[model samples]
Every structure is written in C-alpha cells, then in structure tokens.
Target: MPRSTHRAAPTPPGGLSRRTPDAAVPLRPLGRLHDVASALTALLASDLKEHGLTAPAFHILAVLRRAGPDHRLTTGRLAAIDMVTCSGMTVRADKLEKSGLVVRERDENDRRVVHLRLTERGLRLTDRVLAGLHAREARLTAGFDADELRALAGLADRLERALQHSAGAFRPVPPPH
Candidate 1:
C-alpha cells in the first residue's frame, strides 16, 4: 500500500530537524488536516455512490428535505446554499428530475421563475441517505463524546473564520438565511 502523504518530520538528534524548512512549521499541520479531510470526503463519496447519488446531488436532496415539502426553493437559492455554481446546481437538478427524485415547477404567476421540490421517492431517499450519513459520521467520531464533538466543531469553525480572513481571494460567505 502507498504511504500517507502526511508523514511527520523525524525529530533530529538534538530535537531540531533539518529536513523541512522553518516556513513549513504551520503548513505541516494544515497539510495533515487536508489529507484527513480529503480521505474522509472520499469515503463519504463512496458511501453516497452505493445509494446512486453523488455528494453534490445529496447536498441538494438534503437541503430540500430540510426545507420541507411545501417550502420549495429556486435553483439560485440551492446553488447559493451548496456553494456551487448555478450551472452546477442546474445539472444536478436535471439529473434528479430525470431520475424522478425531484420535481421542478414553473411559477403560476411568473413564467420565468422556477421552483423545486422533492418527490415522495426523493423524500424517502433523502431520509435514508441522511440517516446513513449521520450514522457513519458518528462511527467515524466514535472516540469523541458529545462535548468533544461540540468543541471540535467550534474549533473547526474558528479555523474556517481565520482562513477566511487571511485569504484575500475568499469572498465573504454570509450566514444562511
């Protein structure tokens, strides 16, 4: 098997390693974090595939399920919620519509406006997918209790905010309304 990309630097004889540059001190942890995130995402994607869904597609289904059957949202809203391009959301919506998992309707009052809602099939699928995901997440965090989980989430949020401020290229992401 291939070695992990996030190998830690060996401690030198005098506790000063010369293999890595001084600038990489912070980057080492970040790299490890990225590695773990990438691996976890891949695992989640694999799980989704078994359900005949992709991560992006599941995000839409989950969002719709959360919004309830009567509260239909537009493609733009879904795109914003998923942090994806409108075209990306449209493509996912198209696939879901074709699969009979979602229904898209034109506004009765305005022909230009389109709204989306989950079908009965979609509702059931979303429930199963979300439940499985939640269970998988819990298993992945098996060592952590509720308090630890909350603390980890708080720390992660802090890291996200720090990166958002440090990265000039990042646009301001507003709280979901």
Candidate 2:
C-alpha cells in the first residue's frame, strides 16, 4: 500500500482539539475589530494627506498641541509616546522645524536634551486637523444612539484591556545589550 500523507488533528487528554467550537466564536468579533481599525486608520491617513502630513508627523503635532499652552515636549518623549526610535523622531522634528511648524530648543538646565515646541502656525494647523477629524468621526457614528455609543465605547475599552493582558504572554524577549 502507498504511504498515507494525511495527518489527524491532535486532541487533548480530554479528547477535545485545541481549536474547539468555542474557540472559533471569539475570532468572529476579532475579525470585525480588525476591519474597523483598518478603516479608521485609512480615514486618518486620507485626512492627513490633504494637509501634507504623514500619520507620524500628525501625531507629533497633536502631542505637542495637547502638551499645554506652550505646546512643548522633549524630542525623546515624543519618540517614546509614538513608539518610534529616537532617530525617527529626529527626522520628523527636522521636517517640522524646517516647515516652521515646530522649533527645537535646548533644555535650559540640561543642555544635552532638546525640546520641540510648536509654533503659532503648528498650533493652528493641529487645531484645524483635530476639529476635522472629530467632525468626521462623529458623522461616522451618527447611526448609533447616544446610549449605544456609550455602550460601544465601554465595550471597546474593556476589549483593549483584555487584549493588552493577553499580549503580555506573547511579548518577545529583548536582545542582549
């Protein structure tokens, strides 16, 4: 007889496969969550394109705008908040500085550190962009009633916390320094 190539699914001691019917149910919502996230990201990118800003650059401006009336943050802090490398933040800062959107100032007490402060032009632009994004988001959720929106937001927050907890298990070990 010819050798058989098919393999059977592995079953646990309880005689149930790891990929049980219950396991599949949770995945449907996860798939929908992915689609929603992707659509929102695309909308943001499209809006940013109209203002000649990449997502990261927009994020940098937004962070500074939220900092305070002075709209300042350290370059390193911006990198950490955006989860980008220092060099990457530097590149974004350089572009913003050249465009008159941000100014880089040396820390008074710590000469080694640099702070990025948004200029008047930068603040105005960030405000405009944020307003537009908020308006569009509101329109996107117009179909949902106030209570429904509140419930959805609460559920989303819970899902985010749950995912963060689960992600801890799969975090990769850091490379040796």
Candidate 3:
C-alpha cells in the first residue's frame, strides 16, 4: 500500500477562523474600537480629575468657553448638548456658578428663559484643561504620522455618521430647570 499523508486546512485570507462562533464574526473590529475609546476616556478622566473637574463639568465649561462672549446658549440648549435632564443641567450649572466658572442670566423679554455664560475664571480654566488634553493627545499619538491620524479620524467620522443614522443613536436631552 502507498503511504498516506494528511494536512490541516488553513484559515482564509481575512483570518476569520472556522472555529469561531457565528455571533462573533463581526464583533472583533467593533469591540477593539470600543476598547480603544475606553482607554482614551480613562486617560482624559484622570486628567480632568487632577484639575478638580469632573468630565461633565469640564465638557460643559469647554462648550461654553468655546462659544464667543456675544452669544450664549440657553440652558435648555446646554442640557441638550450635555445629553442630560433639565434638572441635571441645573445641578451642573449650580456647581459651576459656585465655582465662579459660569453665570446664568434671565432673558429680559422672557424671564422664564435663562442662558448660561462662561466667566473669566471659567475661560481660563477651560484653556488650561484644553492645553493639558492636547498635550496628552500628542503623547498618545506620537507614534502616528499626520496621514495615519487623518485616516483614523476619517474612519471615526464615517462610523459616527452611520451610527447617527440609526434610530438608537443618542441625542442630547434638555436639562431640567
């Protein structure tokens, strides 16, 4: 009798193993992206804490500071941007006001309407926070060239837009007054 030989089958070009469960087929890339985002968020959260600001507070301050002094967003709008309830927005505004970082002004025509503005102290703090974050981001991306960064950013943008098209995508909620 002639000698018999046997060989194992090879995985395909994309590395999708035949042994993997059907449910995990498309989760690898998405899961990896989530992990990367979580890591970056943790780094940012630590930086924010070191500056005596929570992530939400820092985000709200940055948004207001970025808006020019002439025009301020209404509290409702801020709540929407923050994706929090109206009452939640008030709590944030209260904390910021106590810190002298933000001010609430009532509309002359409509006393019911209120707008949030950043104070000089808030502006200065936001600037410092931004600088630290930029430095941190630079450190994180030190290995990547501009082209690679752009490509990654482009991918993120596309993914974000696609997610937004879905009904379950998060939309900012108005804060409680």
- List the candidates' TM-scores in order: 0.76, 0.78, 0.78
Model 3 weakest 10-residue run by lDDT: 18-27
lDDT of 1 by residue, 16-76 (tens): 3334343233336665576679879998899889989988888788777777546467877
Model 2, 64-144: lDDT tens digits are 888877789888888888778999999999999998999999999999999999999999999999999999988999999
Off by over 4 Å in 3: 1-27, 172-177
What would the TM-score be for candidate 1 when compared with the true structure? Answer: 0.76
Q: Of models 1 and 2, which has the larger TM-score?
A: 2
Note the Cα lDDT for every prediction shown: 0.78, 0.81, 0.78
Residue 149 lDDT in candidate 2: 95
**Whole-model lDDT, candidate 3?**
0.78
- Put down candidate 3 lDDT per residue, 1-177, tens digits, no spaces: 543343334434453434433322333677667667887899889988988899999988877876666436688888888878999999999998999988899988999999988887888889999999999889989999999999999998888778877898745333333
Question: Native-vs-model 1 lDDT?
Answer: 0.78
On TM-score, the leading prediction is: 2
Better of 1 and 2 by lDDT: 2
The lDDT ranking, best first, is 2, 3, 1
